[model samples]
Target: MALCLLSPGQGSQSPDMLARLAADPATAGTLATLAPLAGDEALRVAADPARCFANRHAQPLLCLYALAVGAALSAEGVEAALVAGYSVGELAAYGLAGALPAAAVLRAAAARAQAMDDCAPADSGMLAVRGVAIGEIEALAAAHGVDVAICNGDEHAVLAGPQCALDALATTLAAQRGAHVVSLPIGVPAHSRWLQPAVAPFAATLAALPWQRGALPVLAGVSAEPVRAPERAVETLSRQLAATIDWARVLDVAVEMGTTVFFEVGPGNALARMARERHPGLPARALADFASVAGAAAWLRRQLA
Candidate 1:
């Protein structure tokens, strides 16, 4: 059997999310640790996903949710051969793969969030452009003074730019053939050169952090392959801020690495939807929005069985 792949990311969080999580004392306890990172009011704010998108709230919120799902899977004795993360979700993947303790992962997440927010000025923005060819999107970005923050697939690329540039780009995209754009709810532009100022300080913090040796193969978002050493992982994280995410290529490499079945472990069905559309026939499931604990656990167990 091939390994189960967990998709880590930030796009699908909501405030009513915890209401769906129910009263697992363990998960509740795990949720408690997020308070200090987000604030005593974190849980309340999480009831709406939009609130969590605030820079300070987003980092810790994503880390907490990722940890909650991973902890639940671990408690169920579920194991995968390899794991990978998208952007901020990489920290969660590292923790799940035993590359670092959960506490260390949380610290990294917090630091990363802070660094991005600190480095970004007040007027940058991100836009999700749908129905655009990769070539055309790149061309459009260049023509409009914007950067590709993430290449989700051939049709889906995120553009990051200052507000004025974003407005002009959106107008161009709307006028372009086969293009529609949606602005993202992010505090700062991510996965673009806009984050370059944050790279050095974030890297210095990561260098001081400790990482554990992993027992399972954990792949990289930058290289679309497994990382071999702790330092290598650190190096990737350092460059992450100033790099563009090649998600479609990453998915292809993951498929080649025996990820025949992908279970998106974060709060939204975003990755599952992406995989289904991208591959057409791949086996994929999104696990975070089930109606009940039994429903989710049963679904996962059935898949593994």
Candidate 2:
């Protein structure tokens, strides 16, 4: 049996997330180091639900949360056979795997958010569609001029574009039997072509950061491929900014690679839930489900055993 560590993206942060992590001794120091990197106003922003969901605040905070949990897990002597991050969480995965320093991941996340913000259209956003076929989703997105941002599976995908277009698409999809559509909290069109302008600048930011070989492999969100070298990491990381994320492929690759258990090292259990829904029978849990890191580690030990 093998363990795969997962880190969540935006839409996973909670108002009391910082407070919860602060109460954990194993993660406190890491949070302290990450809080400032997120911003001088990070703590305040985290406390306010309105501000925390903004791309500028959400990106760094999510990365910080993931890094803190990752550090806590490592302190407990838990090692991952693989690591995969969703959207912004990809940066934290690198930090957890030792490709970059924890501090550097926060910086990169901040820069990435800024880059995305620079190109984001005023009314752009994302919408999640479930219980629908990919072909229908693509056709609807094409008709509405939106783009498929992330493919979670054949029946689940995220679309991004103007708010009005997303609303139209959602209306159409919601009318269908067994279809569910929900607007995501993320304000920017993350993996859509609308984010193309953000790529070059973010690439420069990542290229400037110091990198080293990680202890474990990380699955690239843009593709289901393993990233072992710095150049590959840089390419996939920056390219994914405006490219479609094949998250379904990531999960399939993880299972094929012998991932018997999945652990989400962040505030919410969304990633874990997705893993369970997609692969049924695979054990998956999130850090937020446990009262302490040690408890999570113990659970992981049992699952792995």
Candidate 3:
């Protein structure tokens, strides 16, 4: 196993989804321990699934979900050499990589969410644009006031800006060329300048909080590389507000490191799907469902056999 990459973060929570893990004593105990910070609402939101789509709720819940699943895998003697996370998932990545405690992760997540919510504007939102060339999207963004917030792949991306700009882009994408556009459930425009207001406060929170050097190599969503310093944590955390997310780079880097298996440790399988999209040759699977975990584990055992 050259690298067993574990991804933790938002947009993966589903209702009744974690019940299987909760039933497993090894997994449930860790989850039970996090109840105070995470709360029963995490399960309720996971059951609904859509609730996890909200940034305010998703941020912290995903942290707990990531910690729980990552903890379970470690309990099973599975070890990952490198770990990376996207957006809010970065905190969970930190915990799984032993850069922070589960409590600290949740606390940071909660504080971050509150800070983001407090600073986020009411009209701003994000949009997912698919099946378009990056150059075309880049050109479009330049033409409009929008920014390329997330580059999931060379062809797939998300543009963020004011509602008017996003709506105009949506029309343009459909009218000029055939492109799929969907409004992301997230309200605040993430990874765009629209979040500039939240950066400082969130950074201050991170700076005040104690963060240790990571035990395992931890890749950052801000630059798609390993973040090595405690101070860099605050900088990266703050950059999330005004930076573009290069998820494609994240996946490519892991593959280059000989990452044969990717475990998306959370309630949803979004990152795993992205892994398959970005690297079809490599095996990428989610640890969302127990059956999925068992299947991936068995496959890995065969590969490592």
- Candidate 2 residues lying further than 4 Å off, grouped into runs, are none
Which pairs of residues have clashing backbones in candidate 3? Answer: 9-89, 12-268, 14-46, 15-46, 15-47, 16-47
lDDT at residue 97 of model 3 (Cα atoms): 83
lDDT of 3 by residue, 165-263 (tens): 888999999788899998877777788887788888888878876577747777777677777687777798688777998888988887777788777
Alpha carbon lDDT of each predicted model = 0.75, 0.91, 0.77
- Write candidate 1's Cα lDDT for 186-220 as tens digits: 75888888889998998888787777774566677
lDDT of 2 by residue, 1-72 (tens): 899999999889999999888888988887877799888988889989889899998999999898888888
2 or 3: which has the higher lDDT? 2
Q: Return the candidate ranking by TM-score, descending.
A: 2, 1, 3
Ranked by TM-score, the better of candidates 1 and 3 is: 1
* Backbone clash tally (model 3): 6
- After superposing candidate 3 on the true structure, give the runs of residues whose Cα lies further than 4 Å from its correct spot: 48-51, 289-295
Q: Give the better candidate number (1 or 2) by TM-score.
A: 2
